[model samples]
Target: MDHGSSHDDEVLGKAFDLRLMRRLVRFLVPYRGLFSVCVLLILVLTGIQSGLPYISKIAIDRFLTLPWAIVTVESAPGSGAPIPLGDDRYLVEISSLSPELRKEWEISGVLSPTRYLFVEEDSDKEGIALEHPDLFAPIAGGYIASESALRSLSPSETLSLRSGAIAGLIRLSILFAIALIVRFVFGVSQVYLLQLTGQKVMYDMRREIFGHVLRLPLSYFDRAPVGRLVTRVTNDVAAINEMFTSMLVNLFRDAFLIFAVMGIMFHLEWRVALVILALFPLIVIAAFEFRRRARAAYREVRRQIARLNAYLQESISGMRIVQLFVQEVKANERFAKINIDKYKASMRQLLTFAVFRPLMSFLSSFAVAIVIWYGGLNVLRGSLSLGALTAFIQYVRMLFEPILELSQGYNILQGAMAAAERIFILLDEPEEDRGGGEAIEEVEGRIEFRNVWFAYNDEEWILKDVSFTVEPGERVAIVGPTGSGKTTIIRLLLRMYPLQKGEILLDGVPIERLDLGFLRSRMAVVLQDVFLFSGDIMDNIRLRAEIPEEEAIEAARFANADFVEDLPDGYRTEVKERGVTLSVGERQLLSFARAVAFKPEILVLDEATASIDSQTESLIQRSLTKIMEDRTSIVIAHRLSTIREADKIIVLHKGKVVEEGTHTELLARGGLYAALHRLQFAELGGGTDPAPPSPSFSEG
Candidate 1:
C-alpha cells in the first residue's frame, strides 16, 4: 500500500465545487417536494424577519416621535398638501416628506425647524391645551404646540395633552408584538423542515454507497483499508448531511435576509442605505480573505481528523497483538503523535475563525458608524426623520449578519467538498464485472486452469504457468508444502482475483464469459478458518438464503455437525462475532454445513480439517466421505494421509507442479511428495494416524 494514497484520497477540495454540488444535489431529488417547501418557508420567514425592523420604524415615526410640523405654504396650495391652522401656520406630518422634498421646503423657508405634537380637541386634552394657549396654535379641531413649548407645562398637563399620541403608540406596539410571534413560529417550521430533508438525503446517499461497496471486486479491498471505506459510508456521508442542513439551507435564508434588509433600508432612507451599501466592497474583501484562510485551515483539520480516525481504528482492532508483544508504549506514542497533529490542526481552524469573526464585527460596526455619521447630519438638517435613521442602523447590522453566516457556510462547504470527493471516488470505481457475461442455470463442474499466471502486486508471481484439470465428479486433491500456492488455486477457481495470463474454464466454458454471480453459485468453498456473522446458527448455515429451517438441519446432519443439537438452543444457537465462542473444530463443522446448504455442483476444501483435534478429526472424517460423495471435489491438504484415498493427487513445489499421481504412486517415485510424506510420518513416529500439521499455509 502506498501510504501516500491516504493523502491522495484527502483531496484539498474547493470551498465551492459546482460539479460536486450537482452530484450532491442528486440525493435531494427524491425529497424535492419537501425540499422546495423548505425553501419557500425560508423566503416567507425572511420576509417576516425583515419586516420586524420596519414595524419598529412605523411605531417610532408615526406614533412616538413628534408627529406634526408647521409649514408656511403661502395660503395653502391647490393640492391641499397641509392642513391650514391660521395666520400662515399649516400642520403637516413630519414623517411624510421625502429627503428631496424636505430640502425644497427648507430652501424656501417654509418648513419648521422645530418638531411638534398635535392635540386633538377631546374633553380631557382640550382643557390642557387651553392652559398652554400662548404656545399652542388653534386649528380646525385641535391645537398644535411646538415640542419645546410643551416642556413648560406641568408634567401631568403635558401627558394629558399628548394622550392621543400614546394611544397610537399602543396600537403600533401591538402590531410589532404580533410580527415577532409570527416570525418565531415560521422560523421553527423552516428549521424543522430543512433538517428533516437533510436527514432523508443522507439516508439515500449512505444506502447507495453501501450497496456499491458490496458489488466492488475483492481486489479493491486489498488496496483500501477497512477503516477508510467505513469512514466514507459513515463520517464522510455525515459531513455532507451537515452541509445540506447548515450551509445550503442557510445560504438561501441569509441571502434573502440580506437583500430584504437592503431593500428596507433603501425604502426608509436611501442616502443612509447607500452609505452602508458602499461599505459592502470592504465587507466582500474581508469575507473573501476569511473564506480563503478558513478553507485552507478547515481542509487541514479534516485531513488530520481522517488520519486520526484511521489510526484509532487500526489500534483498537490490533490491541491484542500490541499487548502480547509488549508494544503498548510504542503504540501509545504513535497515537499521541497523530492525536497531537489533529489538535494542532484544530487550533489553526479555531484561530482562523477567531480572527475572521472579529474582523467581520469591525466591518459591521464601521457600517453602523457611517450610517450614524451621515444620517445624523440629515436628521439635524431636518431632511431625514430620526425614525428612518434608527431603522437604517438596525438594517446595517442585519446586512452584516448574513455575511457572517455565509462565512460559516463557506467553512461547512469546504469540508463537505473534500468528503464528497473521497466518497465519489469510491463510488466511481467500476463495480465488479457483473455485466456482459453469459448466464447459465447449471454446470457439470469440470474445472480447468490453463496456463495461468498471477500476482498480487506487479510481477511477484504466486502462480506461474499453472495448468491443472479436475474432471467432472472426480475427487482431485492438491498437496504442497507451505507457501506453495495451494490456496491460490482455489481462490483463482472462484474468480476471487483476476488472472494476469491464461483462462479458467468451468465445463469447458471460459469462466470470464459466465456471469460472475451465476458462476460463483456453482461452487462452495470451505476453508480452515470459518467466518461467522452475528446471528443464530440457522442463519449461519443458510447464510441468509431462502433455505428452510428443515434444510439447515438436514445440511448440519449431513456434515455431522451434531454438537449443534446438544447445544442449549440447537440450530438456533446465537453465534458471536467470528464464532469466537465456538471451538475450532465446531467452526469447521459449521462451514461444511453452510456449504451443503448452498447445494453447489462443486466443493473446494482448502485444509478444512488442518487445525482439528484427533477426536474431532475422527468425527469429521466420517462426514467427509458422505458429503463429497459423487461431487466434483478439489481439496488442498497439508496432511498427506488425508489425501491417500483421493483419486489423484497433484504436488506443487514453490510456484510449479512438481509431481502428479496417486499417493502410492508418488511415494514409489520418491520425489518431493515422497520426501514430504516420509518427513511427516517420521515426525509422527512412523505412525499411520494422521495428526494435524504444525504449519498452516496461505499464499500471500
Candidate 2:
C-alpha cells in the first residue's frame, strides 16, 4: 500500500451549516442540564445588563433635578384669613381681607407682589392690570402666584424638600449599586458554567474521535499523516471548544442584549428607534462581507498549518537520511517554504479581523452620533426629556456592541464549522471489518493456504496463486529473495489484510469464517523490526496482558534473554522512546520474550534474527527449538543457515512458489535454494562443502 498523500485538506463549508449544527448538538445531549443552566445565566445576565442604563436615566431625571409644585387655596365663612404660599407669602383676595389682616400681610416676606384682574368686574371693560406681571399670571379669575419667583419657603418646608430630594438620590444610588453587583455575580457565574460545559463537551468529542481513529484499518494510516490526525484530535477539537465556550453562549447574550436595547429605545421614543433601525442594513451587509472573507482566510490557515506540520514531522523522522545524504539545505528550503505559506495564510486571517474590527467600531460610533444629533433636537423642543435622550444614546451604543461582537463571533463560528467538518469526516471513516463468523476458544494449529492471490493495489499481485499447508505441530520455513512475497504470506496468515482471491484455513475451517480477534489471538508473530514502547522492560514483555510476573520471567529465561536480569532494575528497566537506549539485538531479544509470554499455539517469525550478534544468535537458536517444541511454526528466513533443519522448506520467486522440500533435498535438486545456499557459502569464504550443524545457525 502506498503510504503517502492524504486527501483531507478540503475547503470549509458555510459559517452556519445546519447539518453540521445538528450533528454537533448531539454531543451536548448528555450534558443538557449544564447547558441549560448556562443558557439561563446568559438570559439573566442580559436582563441585568439592559436594566443598568434605564436605572441611570431614572436617577438623572428624577432625583438630580427639582420639580415644580402647585398649591390651591379656598376661603371659609367667618374665617377671612390669608393662605400662606411660601416664606410667609399670603394669597388674600382684595374683598376678603380686613384692614388689620392686610397690615399683617404687608409685614410678611412678600416684598412686591404681582396682582392681576381677579375676574373682569365689568363685562365690556378691562380692570386694572397687575404691576408684577412677570411674577404672576392670571389663570381663571383669582390671581395665581409663583412662590419660586415671588417668595421664599418657610424653614420647615425648605428642610422637608431638601430631605425628600436627598432620600430620592440615595434610593436611586442604592438601586444602581445593586444592579451592578448582581450583574457582576451573574456574569461570573455564566462564564464559569459556559467554560465548564465547553470543556466537558470537548472531552467527549476528543475521546470519541481518538477512539475512532484507533479502530480504523491500517490501510487508512498508510495515507493519513500522524500530524494531521494529531491536529484533528487536538487543534481541531480546541476550535470547537472555543465555539462552545465563547461563541455559543455569547451568541444568545448578544442577541438578547440587542433585543432588550431595541425594546427600551422604542418604548422611550419610537422615532429615535426608527433612526437606529435604518443603520441595521449597513451593519448586516458589513457582517456578511466579513463572514465570507474570514471563512476563506481561516480555512486556508487550517490547511496551511496542516501542511506545515506534516512536513515538519516527515523531516524530523527522516533527519537521519537527510543528514546522511548531506541534504540539510534542501530540507530546510522545503520547510521554509511551508512555514512561509502558513505565515501568509495566518496574516490573511489577521488582516481580515483587523479590518472588520475597526470598521465595526467606526460604524458603532456613527450610530451613536446619529442618536445624539436627532435625540438632542427633540430634547431642545421639550418633546423628549433630557434624561430619556441620554438613555437612548446609551442604548444605541449597547446595540452596536452586540453587533460588533456578533461579527467577531461569526469568525469563530466559521473556524468551528471548519474544524467540525474535518472531525466528522474522520469519525465517518469505516472501521476495520469485524467479520460475522463463529468464534473459537482454541485452534489445533493446522494451517493451509489455497489458491491465494493478493495485491496491495489493482491486480499487480504480490502473492500469485500460492498454495501451501503445514500439519499440526509442524515447522515450515519459507525462503525467497526480496519482493518474492515471503513476508506477505506471514501477513496473510495473521489476517492483517483481507484475501483478495483465496481461502486460508486453520484446522480445516476457513480463516475468513473465523472470528477476527479469536483467530489472531491463537498466533504470535515476531517481526524483524522490533518496536518498543516507552515503558519498563517488564511491561514491554507482557504488554499489559495480565501475565503473572513468574510466567514473564520464565518466558524471558526460555527466550535466553538473561541480559535483562543483569540490568540495574532487571525487568523493571525503563525503555526510552522506541527503545533507543537498547541495542537492536537487545530489542529483538525482548520481542522474542514477548512472543513467548503470549504462549500462542502457532509461532510466525519473519526475519527475526537478522540483526543479532553471533553470541546472541547462539542463545536465540537454542531458544527457537524450545519455542517450537510442540507448536506449528512458520519461519521466513533470509540466512540459509537459519532454516537448514526445517521439516519443510518452500522456495518462492517472483510471487510464485518454485520448490518445496527439506534443505538437503532442495540442495541436491540444485534449484533456487541450492543457488542461494552456494552464494552464502561463497560469501563466508567456504567452498561448496556443507558446514557442520550448529545451534547458532538454527532457525531464528
Candidate 3:
C-alpha cells in the first residue's frame, strides 16, 4: 500500500451545503450560554480594536504639536509668570520682559524653590532688598517701577487653549493603550477556553459515534464502507476544529469591526464615508461568491479522501488474498485510479482558494484606492485636513479587513458542515434488536425456529419457512451447503439482523422479547474468521472483565492453547495488529479461549474447526466434550468427524431440512445425510466404522 495515495487522491467539490451547516449548529445548542459570553467578549474586543488606529491619528494631530499655552504674571518685577511646562521641564518668568533675559529671571525662581540660598545677603528672613538697582525692579504700585512687556498675554492665552486640547489627546492615547492590553489578555483567554471546550465536545462526540456504530444492526455495515466511517470519527471531526474555534469567535469580531469602523467614518465626514459605502456592496458580493465555490471544493476534497481511505483499508485487510492470487499489479492499478481522482480533487480545491483569496485582496485594495483618490482631493481643497484624510483612508482599509476574515471563516464553516452530515448519518442509522422486554439471567437453550422466512433483499427469499428445534443442553449440529442459510440462522439467533417472518424462542420465551445486551453476554460465539485486538493474550481472552492472571491461564489451558506459554513472554506476549504474530491455528485457539472465559450459557461454534490442522482439530475435539458438558451448544459444521457424536444432527439443503436424527440413524436412512457421510468417508479413505445404527430410530 502506498501511503502517498492518501494525499494524492482526495476529492474536491461542493458536496456539503447549507443544510449540513444547520444540522451542525444544533450541537452548540447546549453551549449557547457560553457561546453568548464569548460573542459578547468578541464584540467588546472588536470595538476596542477598531478605534486603535483612529486614536493613533488623534494623538499624532494634537499632542504631537508644540505647546500652545503660556501663563503670564505681571508682578511688578517680583511676582513670577508660569509658562506651561516645556515638554517635561518647568519655566518661570520673574517679570514681564524681553525673551532674551527670561531664562536668567526663571533661574532665580528655580533656586528660590530649592533652598532660598544666600537669603539675599541681608541675614533677615522677613525681606531682602537688592544692593544693585540694575538687577531688581520695583513694581509701579511700589516705588518708581516702570514695566514694559514683549509678547503679551494674548499669545499666552492661545497657547493655553492648545495645551488643553493636547492634554485631552494624550489622555485618549493612554486609554487606547489600556484597551489594547485588555484585548490581548482577553483574546488569549478566550482562545484557550474555546479550545478546551471544543476538544471536550470532540471527545464526547467520538465516543457517542463509536457507541452508536456498534449498536447499529450488522446489516448496516454491509452497505457502509468501514474506512469512510472511521474517517467520519477521525479526520472529518478534526477538520471542524477550526470552525469550533475561530468561526465561533470571529462571527462577532468581524461583524463588530466592520460596523464600528463604518459608523465612525460616517460621523467623521459623510461625503468621504459614502465612498466606502459604495464599495461595501462589491466586497460583500465577492465574499459570498467566493464562499460558495470554496465550500463546494472543500466538500469534494473530503469525499475523495474518504473514498481513497476506504480503498486502502480494504486492500490492506485483504493483502494475503491479493498475494496468493498474484493480482498485485491489478490492485495497484485500481488504487492508482482512486489516487489520481483524489489528486485532481485536491488541486481543484487549492485552485478555488487561490482565486477566492486574491479576489478578496483585490476588493480591499480597490476600497483603499477610492479613499486615497477622493480624500486626497478633499485635503487639497481645504475641505479636510491632511491628518483627517490619512485617518479616513485607514478606515477604508479597516472595512475590507473583515471581508478577508469572513472568507476564511467560510472555509471553516464548510468543513464543519461536511463532518456534521456524516455524524448525523451515523446517528440516524437503525439500532439492533434490543428486545421489547427484560432478559432472563438463566436461559434454557431449547431454541425453536417456527416458519422463519427472510431475505436480505426483497427480490428473493434466502430462508424459506425454516423450522427446527434443539433440546436444552443438546449438542446439535446444523449441517448444510454454502448459501444454505446456515450462517443466516446464526445471525438471526444473535439478533444481529431481524428475521423477516419468524419467532425464535429460548425456553418458551420469544428471542425478540429478551434484552439484547444480556442475551449477547450469555451467548458466546467463535467464528472461522476471528478478529483479535492489538494487546496481550490475556487481554484478548478477558476482553470485558479484568480476570486474574491465573484464571486467564486456566482458560487458555482448557481451550488447549497452552502453546501461548511457549511464546517469548507467555501470556503477556504482545499481539501485533490483527494478531499477525500468531498463526491462524493459534489465533483460533485464542478465540476459543475467549469464548470459554465468558462462561456463556449457550456457545455457538460456526466453522470453528475449519482453519485448524488435524492435530489441532483433535486437540479441540478433546476439549469440546468437557466444555459442552453442561452448556447447550449450537455447532454449525461441515466436517463429518466433528459432528459424528452430536446428540442430534440436522441436514439442510437449500434452506430446507432434508433429514434429522442421531448420526448412526441418519447413516442408516441413506438420504441426504448418508450421502454427505459417504462423501466425507471416501475423501478421508476411512473404509468403515463399527458404530451401529439403533434398531428402532425415528427420523423426520
Candidate 4:
C-alpha cells in the first residue's frame, strides 16, 4: 500500500514480534510471582474444564448398566433367546461364547442398544465394580425408592458387578459441583488479576510517555502537532491496555484448554482423535490468512482515527480564528472528508472481522460433524462407548473455543501493535544537543551571537551567519520586519536549537558549556502572547519561582500592574480560562511583573506591548526602564517609541544586521533602518531626543 498504510502495518506488526513481546513482558517481571500463580491457576482450571465431559460419560455408562443384562451370548433351549449369565440380573454381565462367533467378537466386536443385563460375582475382590450401596440409599430413594430397594441387594444372597451403577446419580452430582466451582473460582480470579494488572500498567504507561514528552526539545514540539501527540498518550496506550487486560490472557487460556482436552481425547483413543484433529491444519491456514488481512484493515482504522482526532482538536482550538476569517465552511468540508475516510476504514475492518469470525466458526463446526459421524459408527461397532462418544463431542466443541479466542486476540493485538509503533517512534526521537563541554559554574549576562546559521528544516536557512553582541548590563532593542528571524536569534542564544556554523557565548564562555537549566534560570522572557496558568494572580506570578509575597507586589508595582489593588481580591484574584478575566494590558503587565519577580540577570521581551493600547503602553514603558536598570536586556520592539531610549538599537533585515547604533545615529546613517523608522514612527512627529536616551554601550 502507501507509506501511511505501511507505517500502520509496522506498528501493528510490533504486537506479533517475538522480541518486542518478550521485552514488553519485562513490565511484569516485578510481579513474576503473581503471573506464575495466575498461569498455574488457569492451567488447573482449563484441565478441569476439559475433563468434565469425560466424567459425565462414566456416569452415563454406570446408569445404562443398572437395568440390563450386562452380558448375554448363549442361546436358550426353547425360546431361542440368549441366556443371561449367573443368578442375578440388572448388572453388567459376561457371557460364554461359541468358538467362531466368539473369535469374531474377540477380534472385532458387536455392540447394539438391546437391553441385556446379567450378573456376575466380584471375583477379583478389588471392589472397583461394586460398592456397599447402603450409604447413598436414602439419596437414591428420594428419586426412585422402588428401584433403590431392588438395587441394594445383599452380597450373601447375590452380588452384581454393576454395583457401581447404584451410586450413578450421586457420582454425577459430585462431578458437576466440582466442575462448576472450578469454573466460578477461575473466572473471578482471572477478572481480578486482569483488571489489577491492566490498571497498574496503564497508569505507568501514561506517566512514562508524558515524562518523555516533557524532556523532549522544544524544537521537536515545534514540528509536532499537539493533538497527534495527545492521541498517542491517550488513545494509543489505551489500545494496548485493552489487549493486555483481556485479549492476550484469554487467548492463552483458550489455546491451553483446547490442547489439553485434545491430549485427553488422544489418550482415550489416538486413532479416533487423529481423525478429529485432521481438520486443524485447514483451520489454522485459513485463520492465519484472515488475520493478516484483518490486521491490515485495522491498522488503517487506527491511522484514520488519529487523523480525525487531530482534525477535531485543531478545529475546536482555532474555532475563533476560523470564524474571523470566514473559513467555517472550508473547515467543515475538511472535517467531513476526514470523517468519511475514517468511516470507510472502520467499515473495511468490520468486513474483515465479519468474514474471519464466521469462517473460524464454520471450520470448527465441520470438525465436530466429522467427529460425530466417525465416533457414532465406532460406538455401533463396539469400538467406542456411548459415554465416550458424548465426551468426544464435548471435546470437539471445546477445540473451537481456542480458535475463536485466538481470532479475537489477533484482532486486538493487531490494533495495539499499530498504535505502539507510532508511540515508540515518538519515544525514539533524539533529545536536545548539549554540546560536549564542561558546565558553567556561573554566568555574568554578557551575550553575543557570532556568525550563527540555522534553519527549522533543510529546505531554506531562516538565519544566515548573523552576528551581534551586547555588553553586560546594557539594554539592546532588536527591531526587524515580520519573519526576519528576530525570535530565532533568541531561540539560538537559548540553545533551543543548535547553531549551524558559529557559537553563542555568555560571559566569555560558549553557551554550550553552561548547564541548560542554569542558563534558563538566569534569563527571563515575556513573549508577545502572554500565557497565564489556571490559578489565582499570585500563583501565576510566582509560577514555581517561590518569590516572597511582598517582593511579588513590589515587582507588580514596577510593571505598572498595581491595578490588582483596585480589584475585589488583589493578587489573589482568580484568572479564568487563559487569563481571560484580566484585560490584555493587565495580562502583559502581570507577565512583566512575573519576570521581574524572578530577579533574572537578563530579560528578553518579544513585542510584549504589541497588543496593548497606547495609554497602557506609556505606563508600561516607565515600568520597563525601571526593571531594565542594571540588567542585560533584549527587547524585540514593534513600537518604535517603546525602544527610543535603548542603550543600543540593532536593525535586522532578512536575518542580517543592517544597522547598529543609537536611534539618532541610525537616522543619520539614512539606510534601511532610516527607511523603517520613517515608515513606522515618522507620522508621530516626535523629536530626536526623548528625555535623554539611555547611554549607548558596545561589545568589549
Best by lDDT: 1
Task: Give candidate 2's whole-model lDDT.
Answer: 0.76
The lDDT for every candidate, in the order shown, is: 0.81, 0.76, 0.69, 0.72
The residue ranges of model 3 lying beyond 4 angstroms of the native Cα positions read 1-26, 29-33, 64-176, 546-549, 687-700
Q: Model 1: per-residue lDDT, tens digit, 1-700?
A: 1222357546775778899989988888889998898888888888877887777777777766787777887666333346787788778876566656666786576887677877778856677778768988777878778777888888778766667777887887788788778878887887898889888888888999999999999779988877788889888898899998888888888988888898888776677788788888989988888888887787788678768766776678878888999999988998898889889999998998899889888889888898889989877776666777888888888899898998778867777888898899999998898734887656787888899999988999999888888888888989887788888888888787888999888888888888888888888899888999888999999986699989989999999997999999988889987798999989999999999999989999998888888778877887877788889999886655558868889888787888899988988999987777776676666536655456332222
Rank order by TM-score, top first?
1, 2, 4, 3
Clashes of 1: 0
Candidate 2 lDDT by residue in tens digits, 81-107? 444554434444433545344333334
Give each model a TM-score: 0.92, 0.83, 0.79, 0.83
Q: In angstroms, how far off is 475's CA in candidate 3?
A: 1.5
- Residue pairs that clash (backbone atoms under 3 angstroms), model 2: none
Error of 2 at 422 (Å): 2.7
Error of 1 at 88 (Å): 6.0
* Candidate 3 Cα RMSD (Å): 11.1
Query: What TM-score, to 2 decimals, does candidate 1 have?
Result: 0.92
Report model 4's TM-score to 2 decimal places.
Answer: 0.83
Cα error, candidate 2, residue 556 (Å) = 0.7
CA error at residue 186 for candidate 3, angstroms: 1.6
Question: Which 10 consecutive residues of model 1 have the lowest summed lDDT?
Answer: 691-700
